[model samples]
Every structure is written in structure tokens, then in C-alpha cells.
Target chain A: MSKLLTDLIEALRCLPGVGGKSAQRMAFHLLERERERGLRLASALEQAMQRIGNCTRCRNFSEEPVCSICASSSRDRHVLCVVESPTELAAIEQATGYRGQYFVLLGRLSPLDGLGPEELGLGLLTERLAEGEIEEMIIATNPTVEGEATAHYLAQLARAAGVKPTRLAHGVPLGGELEYVDRGTLAHAFGSRQSL
Target chain B: MSKLLTDLIEALRCLPGVGGKSAQRMAFHLLERERERGLRLASALEQAMQRIGNCTRCRNFSEEPVCSICASSSRDRHVLCVVESPTELAAIEQATGYRGQYFVLLGRLSPLDGLGPEELGLGLLTERLAEGEIEEMIIATNPTVEGEATAHYLAQLARAAGVKPTRLAHGVPLGGELEYVDRGTLAHAFGSRQSL
Candidate 1:
């Protein structure tokens, strides 16, 4: 086997779910049939890795210093939604008629994993809350242990900042991927949110 | 969402089994965590797409004109194995000690899919057979209808070239992936090959 071929296979294993066999299949599929697409993917990867950065205000992925959502004037600044990750933020965007500004936690409060409030950029979030532009802070974190801990911490921040805090309704299934949950369930959960 | 993030997700969909959601997960996985690996994968993909080409003798993927297996002086020249794909060739390499030479068909005789003997590089195989260097030809195409057809055509070429032709034993489960067969079954099948 050629070293380049081996390197391609090894690099493909870097993908989230791709293991050794899958990496080999992907490598062969590209080399044998999808070379053009493979090259396109390479360029796309290069461009994205070099260009994309977190939104300075919301911590969501963005190529700009402040993401479009944070910079948009049409979105409601007073109704803020805080989620553990950008994936959940996207899910909310797709599943509901949400027009609020967002704060992406990037991760939850997992002390064992060394993910504290500081690591998750909670200080930035507190600053956004204290700015007095946000009236209500919706805690849209997943119902996991770490997520709940992060939500409690966020609720404290919201209360300290003199903002009303709320949690998603029980419509969301426990321990489920918030992004993959049914649109109706997620929408309903967002619509009928309860005070924390 | 950033346009580059969307482009990255779209580009990731080129992988065989990846779909919209998997593509999104891969994009986020890379952006949120594995940026370094993502860049490495990009480089690998670029190099492989630009450098890897067909081996002149075997039609297997290779950076060189002749693949390592075909160029190796230690391998026997009197026995040649005909496989439908490099994947199967790799399987044979791992599952059995049978070593001589190989001719990768790249595809089988799927006429509906526009694949024929010419598309499969049978002309090169025929020229190699006509060299009278190979005393036996092993037709290791899969047991699918198209694969069987390709094997028969290869057998005819071997007979015309005055070389005995053989086929794998029944130990290969019909319609199953040749590369994923258990080591015992594949090794036994190769060891107990029968004359076609």
C-alpha cells in the first residue's frame, strides 16, 4: 500500500463516527470515484478551518467577529436564549419561529471533564446578560446532568443581571439529542417554556 | 450560519454513506473540536486526489505506474488473481497467503450500469495473459450476477491464453461483501479454490 493512501485512510478516521474500516472505505471511494468531490472537500476544509471563528458575542460559529444573529437588528435583543451548544441553537432556529438573540455555552458544566463556567465562556454570557439589553434569558440546555448544572448556573447569572429566567417545557424528551427531536416537540417546548 | 460552514457541511456529503445530518455533525465536529485533524484530512485528500493514479499493470490505485505488489520481485509470475475491485484485492491480501499477481477489474460486468469488459480494463488483463507468463488465472470476482459474468469472461481470456483458470470455493457467502467475510471462511475458500 502507498504511504499517501495510508495517510488518507488515517486522516479520514478523524471524522466523528468514522473508524478504520469506514476510513478505508471513504478513502477508496474518493480515490476510485469521487476525486473531484474529494478535492472540493479538501479546499472547503482548508477554507473553513482557516476562516471560521466563534461569534464574539454569542459564541456561535461564525466567520465574522460577531455572528449574523448577534449583529442583526431585526432579532429581539430583549428575549435571549442560552443553549449549551450551537447545534441546539440551530435546532431552535429550524424548529421554531424564534427571533431572539442567542448565547452559545459551547459545552456544559462537567467538572470531571474540566469544563467549568470559564471554559464554556459563561463570563462572556454574564456580561451579555448584565448589559440590560436582554429582559428574559431562556435556558434551553439539554436535560442532561451537566446541562442542568449549566442551566442552573445560567439562571443565577440571569437573576443577578435582573433578567427573568425560564426553562424549556417538559415537551422535550429526556436524554435525547435536542437537534434530532421532532420539530413539533421542540417548538412546543420553546413555546410553553416555564419559569426556572 | 456562516457560508463557509454551510460549504463545509455540503462538501462533507460527498463521502459514500454521509447524508445531510451526518454532514452537519461532521462539520460541527470539525469546527467545534477537530480542526487540526480536519486540516490534516484536507491535506491528505488533496495529495491523494492529485497524486494517486491507476497502476499500469494491475489497474489498482497507486501513485506509481506499477503498484508495489506488481513491482515486487518476490511474488510469483505464473499465477494471477483477477478481482473486481482493489477492496477485494486487499481482502485477499489480508485473509489469505495466496500471492502471485493481481488484475483489478475496478468494476464488474454491469451492463445496465454501463460497465463492460472494456470499462473494467479487461484489455490490459488479456495482454498480460497473452504474454504466456502466467500458468494459472484465479477468478476471484464476487458471486453476484455481474461478478459471475466478469469471472466467466476472465476465464475465457485465460483459456485463450493457455492458462488454467480457478474460482474461489463455496465458503464465500453468496451476495455478501467479499471483503468482510470471516477470516476462516475467506481463507478456506481461497485454499480450496476449484478449477472453473
Candidate 2:
């Protein structure tokens, strides 16, 4: 193989879930089928790398220090949704019809993985809470152990700061079959059943 | 979303099998964790796009008009292996232990898809056959209907040019169970048994 082609294939392997064969397919597709789009992807990557950075307020991706979510006046400043990543934040925004602001952790607490509250931007979250603008915080982290630990840690901080912090409800998902539902989720759902 | 970040996500979707969610994940990973590698990927894409083009001799990717395979003095110049694409050619080189030069069709004969013998680079194959340097042409296109049709057409061309043409053998793959094998392949394997 040519040096240029080899280098491109090697570099493409850095993408998530991309392996040697997939990288080769991507390289060939770009070179043989979509040269213009390939070049555009290159340019976009370069520009995003140079311009985009962590939003200082919420830690979501942004070109400026403050992201659009943090800067917008239409959103509810009093209600903040805490998420582990920007993708999760976007999912919540779209699926749940959330009109409040968001604080992206970019990761979760995993002691084995050397990730902790500080790494997840808890210090920044505390600072925002100290400003007395946020009335409530929703822990919208995933149900995984790491996400649960991170949410608990954030709740402890919120309690100490006198801010109300609530977790997302855990129950049988809508359209979920009881037979297929796991024991843990079923127990949680039964334990937290709402009274009509 | 920031313009650069949004553009990056949109551009990443051009990769085969990558959807919106995967593209977003890739974009975030590049911006947050792998900026240097992302930049390297961009540079590699740019360099490959600027330097690589189809080899004039065999239609494989090359920086020059003639590819390295076509220019190599060690490979058998009198024998040629014809394949549907460069990926197929590389696969054959790696798996089959074939040391012959290759002619990449780059596409199959699919009239419905507007691909014909001319589009498959058969014109160039014919011109090369007319020169009389090749003694045998191996049809290694594929097992699909289009590939079989292409192989037959190439065989006719080789016969008219007085060059011996052979198709790659069809049989049950090694280590494959007869029960699990498709009926067509099983029949072909039964019919093409070798002498001990």
C-alpha cells in the first residue's frame, strides 16, 4: 500500500468501534467513492478541533467559553439537568421536552477507572449552585453503577449546599414486557409505585 | 450546537455504517479526547486525497500513473488476476498467496446500476490483452451473478485475444460444515471434487 493510504487507514482506526477492516472500508470509500465529502469531513474536523472547546459554565461543547444553553435567556435558569455527556443531554432535550439548562459531566465516577467527582466537573457544579440561581437539580445520569455513583455524589453535594436534587425515576420502561424486565428494575418499580 | 461541531457531526455521517448517533459520538471523541489524532486523520485524508489517484495501468490506487504492482519486476507479468475492486485485490493478495499482477475492475457488471463492461474497466483489459504480454488471465471477480457474468465476458475477451482464461474454483470453503453450507455451494463442491 502507498504511504498516504496506509497513514489514512491507520488514523481512521481511532474512531470508536472502528477496527482494521472497517478503517480500510472507510478509507476506500472516501478515496474511491466520496472524495468531496471526505475533504469536507477533514475540513470540519480541523475547524471543530481549532474552534470548539468545553463551555466554561456547563462543560458542554461550544465555540465560546459559554455554550448556547448557558447563554440563552429563554431556558429556565432555576432548573438544571445533570448529564454524563452531551449526547445524553441532547437525548433528554429531545425526548423529554426539557426546557431547562444542562450541565454535561463529559464522564461519570468510576474509582477503578480513576474518574471522580472533580474529573466530572462537580467543582464547577458546586460553584454554580453557590451562586444561588439554581432552585433544583435533576440527576439525569444513566442507570449504570458509575452513573449512579456520580449521581449520589452530586446529590450529597447538593444536600450540603441546601439545593434540592432529584434522580430520574427508575421503573419498567414504557412498552417493556414484564417477563423480559430484569429483577432489579422490577423490584425498583414495585417499590416506587405511584398511588392513584 | 456550535457551527463547527454541528458541521463536524454532519460531515462524519458520510462514512459507511455511521449513523447520526455514532457520528455525534465520533465528533465528541475527536473534540474531547483525541484532538491530536483527529488532526492527524485530517492531514492524512488531505494528503491521501491530494496524492492518490487510479493507476493508469491496472486502475489500482497510486500516487503515479502506474501502480507499484504493475511496475514491480518481481511479480509474474505474464499472469494477471482480475478482481472487482481494490479491496478484493488486497484480500486475494493476503489470503490466496497469489504472486501475479492484478487488474482491478473497481465495479461489477450491473446493468441495473448503470455499470457495464466498459464501466468495469474491461476496455483497458482488452487493450492490455491485445499487447500479448499476458499468458493467462484469472477471473477472480466474485460469486455473485454480476461477478459470474463479468467473468464470462472477460473469458470471451481473453479467448478472442488468444490468451488463456481461467476462473477461480468454486467449492465449499475449508473448515465449513456441509450442513451449514448453502445448497448451491454444496452442489458446486460435489461436482468439482479433486482426484486423490
Candidate 3:
């Protein structure tokens, strides 16, 4: 194989799930048939890696200092949503009608991984909470152990800043069969049953 | 999402087996963690796309006019192996100690798909066979209908050029159990049993 070809196969393994065989296939596919698209992908990757940065306000990925969501005046400034990562923030935007400002944690409180409050920019979040423009803070962290702990910490911050804090509801997922649902989820759903 | 981020996700979809969700995950993974590797991958892709072209001698992918396999002096020039694609050529090189030279057809003889002898670079292959340097031509095409037809066509070409033609033996695989093997393979194996 050519050095360039081998380099491509090796480099493609940088992707999340790609391994040696998959990388080889991707490399061959690009070389044999998709050279044009492969070049375009290279350019896109270069531009993205060089230009994209975290938004100053929400810490979401953006080419500019402030992301479009954070810069827009039409979104609700009084209500702020806090999530663990840009991926989760995108999920909220796509799946719901969330029109509020966002605060991206970029990670949960993984002390073992050395991702502490400072690493997640909690100080910046605290400053935003104390700015007096935000009346309500919604913590939409995942239901994991670290996420719950992070939510508790954020709620304390919101309260300290005189802002009302709320958490997303968790239970059995919509349209899940009770018999097929996991025991923990079923139990939690039963415990939190709501009145009509 | 930023346009650059979205464009990256879309551009990543050009890779084989990657869909929207996987592309999104790959984009986020690159942005959050593997930005440096991602940039290196970009450079690799660009170089491979721009520099890698087919070997003039064997039609295998190469940065040079002739691929290393075809250009090497140690490889047997008298015994030529024909394969459908560069992937199959690489497979043969890895799985076997076949030190013979190679002629990559790049595609099988699928006339319905408008792939014929000329499209497969068979004219170049015939010219090589006619050069009298090759004494034996090994057909290593896959055991499919199109591959068989291509092998037969290549055999006739070898005979016209006074070169001996041989096909890869087709039977049950080495580790395959007789009872579990498919009927077609079992019958073929039984019919072709040698006097060992």
C-alpha cells in the first residue's frame, strides 16, 4: 500500500467506533469511488477543527464567540437550561420547544476523571445565575449518579443566586410497556405516579 | 448547531456505513476530545485523495505511476494474478505468501452495469500477457457468477497470449465441517476431491 493510503486508514481510526478493518474499508471506499467527497470531508474537517470553539456564554460549540442560540434576543432570557454537553443541548433543542438560554456543562462531575466543577465551568454558570436576568434555572441533567449530584450542586447555586431552580421529570419513558420496562424504571414510575 | 458543525456531520456521512446518528456522535467526539487526531485525519484524507492514483502497470492504487508490487524486482514477473478490486488484492497479499505480480480489474465483468472488458482494463492486461514475460496467469476472482464469467474470459485471453491459465480451487473452506457446509459447496468439494 502507498504511505498516503496507509496514513488514511490509520487516521480514520480517530473516529469513535472505527477500528482497523473498518478504517481500511473507509479508506478504500474513498480512494476507489468517493475521492471528491473525501476531499470535501477533509476540507470540512480542517475548517471545523481550526475555527469552531466553545461559545463564551453557553459553552456550546460555535464558530463565533457567542453561539447563535446565545446571541439571539428572541429566546427567553428569564429562563435558563443547564445540560451536561452540547450533544444533550442539541437533543433538547430538537426534541422540545425549549426557547430559553442554555448553560452547557461539557461534562458531568466525574471526580475520578478529574472533571470537577471548575473543569465544567461552574463558576461561569454561577456568575450567569447571579446576573439577575435569569428568574428560573432548569437542570436537565441525565439520571445518572454523577448527573444527580451535579444537579444538586447546580440547584444550590441557583438558590444562592436567588433564582428558582427546577429539575426535569424522570420516570418510565413514554409508550413503554410496563411488563417490558426495567424494574428500577417501573418502580420509579410507580412511586411518582401523577394525578389527572 | 453551527453551520460548520452541521457541515462536518453531513460531510462525515460520505464514509461507508456511517449514518446521521453515528455522524453526529463522530462530530461531537472529534470536537470534544480528538480535535488533534481529527486535524491529522483531515490532512491524511486530503493527501490520499489528491495524490493516490492507479498504478499504470497493474491498475492498483499508487502514488507512483507503477505500484510497489508491480515495480518490485523480487516479486515473480512470470506468474501474474488477476483480481477484481484493490481490496481483494490486499487480502490475497495479507492472507497468502503469493509473491507473484498482480493485475487489478477494479471491477468484475458486469455487462448489465455497463462494465465490460475495456472498463475492467482487460486490454491493458492482454497487452501485458502478450509481452511474453508472463508464463502463467492465475485467476483469483471471487466465486460469483460475474467473477466466473470474468475468469473464463481472462483464461481465453491467457491462452491467446500462449500463457497457461489456472483458477483458484473452489470447495469447502479449510476449517468448514462437512455436515454443516452448504449443499452446493459440499457437492463441489466432493466432486473435486483429490487423490491425497
Worst 10 residues of 2 chain B by lDDT: B89-98
- How well is each residue in B1-196 modelled by candidate 2, as lDDT tens digits? 8888889999999999999989988987777789999999989988887889989989998888888888889998899899888888778877887888889999988999999878888889889999888999999988999889988898999999999999988998889999999999999989889999
Off by over 4 Å in 1: A110-114, A171-196, B110-117, B171-196
Task: Give the residue spans of candidate 3 off by over 4 A.
Answer: A175-187, B111-114, B174-196
Model 3 Cα lDDT, one tens digit per residue, A108-152: 998999999999999899889778999999999999999999999
Candidate 1: the clashing residue pairs are none
What tens-digit string does per-residue lDDT give for candidate 3 at B66-97?
88998899999899999999999989998999
The lDDT per prediction is 0.90, 0.89, 0.94
* Candidate 1 residue lDDT tens string, A1-196: 8889999999999999999999988998888788999999999999999999899898999999999998998999899999888888988998899999998888899989998889989888888877888899999999777787888888888888899999986688778888899887788788988889
| Alpha carbon lDDT at B33, candidate 1 | 88
Model 2 Cα displacement at B157 (Å)? 2.5
Query: Which has the higher lDDT value, candidate number 1 or candidate number 3?
Result: 3
What is the C-alpha interface RMSD of model 1? 0.8
Candidate order (TM-score) = 3, 2, 1
lDDT of 1 by residue, B1-196 (tens): 8899999999999999999999998988888888999999999999999999989999988999989999999999999999988888888988899879999999999889999879998888889988989999999999777887888888888888899999986688779887999887788788988899
* Runs off by more than 4 Å, candidate 2: A109-120, A144-146, A177-187, B109-120, B175-196
Residue B179 accuracy (lDDT) in model 1: 91
